[model samples]
Target: MSKRIQVTFTKEQWSMIEKFRGILGESDAELIRNIVLIWLSEKSIITTKIKKEMDDENGNRN
Candidate 1:
């Protein structure tokens, strides 16, 4: 079973989403989901890089 979610967006936000959805020929939900997934993946990469940098800095201090 799929869970349902309710989100509220401002007029400008909705307008941007609609424009992208129309250009991509995707549903609102699909566009939103893709954006969310992409953002999450990017954040994960950033976090991993930060951790690695921290580890390298700590190792150099030894």
Candidate 2:
């Protein structure tokens, strides 16, 4: 099942979101979901790289 979430943003933030939505032709939900998914993927890559670097520094690898 999917969960629903509520997000709060300032007027300026809402304005930007609206502009992007109009330009991209995506609904608010779709835009938010896409942004979050992309952010997660990028974060995961950065985290993996950091962990690998730390492991190498400690001479540990599997």
Candidate 3:
């Protein structure tokens, strides 16, 4: 089950959304959902990289 939500985008964001629609030819909801999933995956990768760097620094500090 899914719920409907509303978003108000700035002009710049609206333009970008239109561009995305042109390339994807998907419904706005589908595009947003896919984008969020991809964004979360990228965030996870960056978080892992940062944790590795912190671990390396801590290992060197001792």
**lDDT values for all models:** 0.75, 0.78, 0.73
TM-score of each: 0.57, 0.56, 0.56
Q: Show model 1 residue runs off by greater than 4 Å.
A: 22-25, 45-62
Clashing pairs in 2: none
Model 1 lDDT per residue over 1-62, tens place: 57779889999998887877755458878888777766876778647666678778789532
Q: Write the per-residue lDDT of candidate 2 for residues 1-62, one digit (tens) a residue.
A: 59889999899988877876855458888888776766776778547787788789899985
N/CA/C clash count, model 3: 0
What is the clash count for each candidate, in the order shown?
A: 0, 0, 0
Q: Which residue pairs collide, candidate 3?
A: none
Best by lDDT: 2
The C-alpha stretches of model 3 lying farther than 4 A from their native spots are 22-25, 45-62
How big is the RMSD of model 1? 9.4
Write one digit per residue (lDDT tens) for candidate 3, span 7-54.
888999868877877455588887776666668767785476666787
